[model samples]
Target: MATPVLPRSVQRLIDEFARLPGIGPKSASRLTFYLLRATDNQALDLSVALQELKERTRLCSVCFNITEDDPCPICEDEARDAHLVCVVEEPLDVLAIERSRAYGGRYHVLHGAISPVEGIGPEDLRVTELVQRVAQGQFTEIILATNPTLEGESTALYLQRRLAEYGVRMTRLARGLPVGGDLEYTDEITLGRALEGRQEV
Candidate 1:
């Protein structure tokens, strides 16, 4: 018996699948075969959507969120409270908070947190932009909604100390958030409660 040879096209698909997070080589091979058995339109649609995602999306200039527009809809929203800026670790965090329907303020997405092991420092995030915004003295309160994990806590603490001289009210999310959990994974009800119970930094 001889081993079956995968075509170059199939091998390319497997490579792409492997590039996705959490998709090991075995899983990638499985996905490639799954797609091969799927309808042609399904695969085409997936490809088109992936292409459009990169072509149509860009970082929001104001909040640094992934959006179709430069400023993002949230940054341009007049109904939200401009005096309050909820700072979070990622764009997904913004979505999570928005889903709660409890926060009515604007947002600033940090993109990442400070992690020494990961070689991610404050310079690698949107921290400088946040400092500039605070220097403008336009916001009255900054809600540090970063996750409750060690890295998240460290990032929040660093921001607190750095912005302390800005004279604006600084706050942190309430302590009831599950320890070591990502904000994006938390339930809206729990997130809402945490927001409501936010305390001064």
Candidate 2:
């Protein structure tokens, strides 16, 4: 015998919540019910926040990081070393690095790594823009601060080859970061040490 169907509205909310990463059916049901019982103002606030997040947030034209501003505060900050750029896989990685307070260089967010399994390539990333930026400006160094995963290593190597003609010093993060861990989840102390001990690629 088939299970009885839930009310369509409740089922729809559960389905939406279940689609989120790491949210199982049970958790989705809990969240949907919680939201249903929440104050109308609270739920409306969340809905309005989500709408504004989509409307107010945009990719920074220069670094490709998600920001409310075009250049982003980091890119616009004259105090940062423009000649030394740290290239990361995503905006979350940028936050991880910033939390360490170990770097004072500008950054270039690739938005994602080159993953063959996912059918993502260098062309899918902000690689061409980085190359053009290097061509336009005489940068001294570039750090391939992508994660230590196989896909990250592949992306780093691809960038290395592509930027060979630039003659700019390229470096990779040290082993302080766990081999298979993501930068966004790394502790600040370990991330700081990795930045401090970064080595030539």
Candidate 1: Cα lDDT at 176:
55
Q: Candidate 2 at 181: error in angstroms?
A: 14
Superposition error at 69 for model 1 (Å): 1.2
**Candidate models: Cα lDDT each:** 0.92, 0.92
- Model 1 lDDT vs. the true structure? 0.92
* Candidate 1, superposed: residue stretches over 4 Å from native: 1-4, 177-201
| Candidate 2 pairs with clashing backbones | none
lDDT digits (tens) for residues 1-201 of candidate 1: 977598889999899999999999999999899889999999899999999999999998888989998789999999999999999999889889989899999999999999999999999999999999999989999999999778999999999999999999999877658779999999887798888887889
What lDDT tens digits, residue by residue, belong to model 2 across residues 13-130?
A: 8999999999999999998888899999998999999999999999999998889998899999999998999999999999999999999999999989999899999899999999
TM-score result, candidate 2: 0.84
lDDT of 2 at 142: 93
Clashing pairs in 1: none
